[model samples]
Target: MKICAIRAFTPLTAALGLTLLLLSFGPASSSTGWLLAQDEAPMRGDKKVLTIDDYAKWRSVGQTSISPDGRWVTYAYSRREVDDSLFIKEIDGGDPAVVVRGSNPEFSKDSRWVAYYINPPEQEDGGGRGMREAGTMPTDLHA
Candidate 1:
């Protein structure tokens, strides 16, 4: 499995982790085809970012990213329900914990800030009218 980012460059589709348009990278001595799917991260000093085996560990729909210091990983778990609810798990030395839930989860560049989408569910009224649910911030986790 080659490490490549999704190269469609389009919003493409909204199918859980399939929505990701990642940048793929290749090693030296490779000069055949154009880089597809995703682009490679530009880094120096002979440090490899991630390997194919690591990426295979998690399911595709959920997005995963290595921490800046490479200590922990923050990713979304997208198969909680039939509707594909999201969950953020902080994997460290021990068990991972649920950090948040929703769609399109992301972390800020500094890794201090984070963002996600909140598709509020519609509420039904006794009168048969329905309304979309409002977005709310997480109340039960550290930020």
Candidate 2:
């Protein structure tokens, strides 16, 4: 009896196969009916189509840090068309302290304080044509 060896497709192969499959449809202008149909079809289960207006609500997080005592955490959240904010929260339970237009948080050695950069307000002149600079440090570190 002879046995055949089976081979599994890697991600690259799968992507290439999909690309070839799509390319087989010929020019997009002439063969995009099926793709357009999928977009135009009514979604089931109360699903709604996404629009450009929803992009402003999207947010991203970066530069996370935890205090040495493991009781606190700091992170930065940024949104499109809006200012970024830094948040310092107690791990166990407490309301978080929010710093508007802040990023890159760091905990002090004793875990009693935090340091972060404060971004300058956005400039409206020519929609910010010039290059923006880094955030400035706070002169007063007191709470």
Cα error, candidate 2, residue 46 (Å): 5.6
* C-alpha TM-score for every candidate: 0.35, 0.56
* Segments of candidate 1 deviating more than 4 angstroms: 1-61, 94-101, 122-143
Q: By lDDT, who's the top model here?
A: 2
- Residues 4-109 of candidate 1 have per-residue lDDT tens digits of 3454544322221232222111232122222221224344677435455333322234555433333334455432222334444343343344433355555544
**Candidate 2 at 37: error in angstroms?**
25
lDDT of each: 0.38, 0.54
Top-TM-score structure, candidate number: 2
Q: Clashes in each model (backbone N, CA, C under 3 Å)?
A: 16, 0
lDDT of 2 by residue, 41-62 (tens): 3357776464665545444455
Q: How high is the lDDT of residue 29 in model 2?
A: 20
Whole-structure CA lDDT of model 1: 0.38
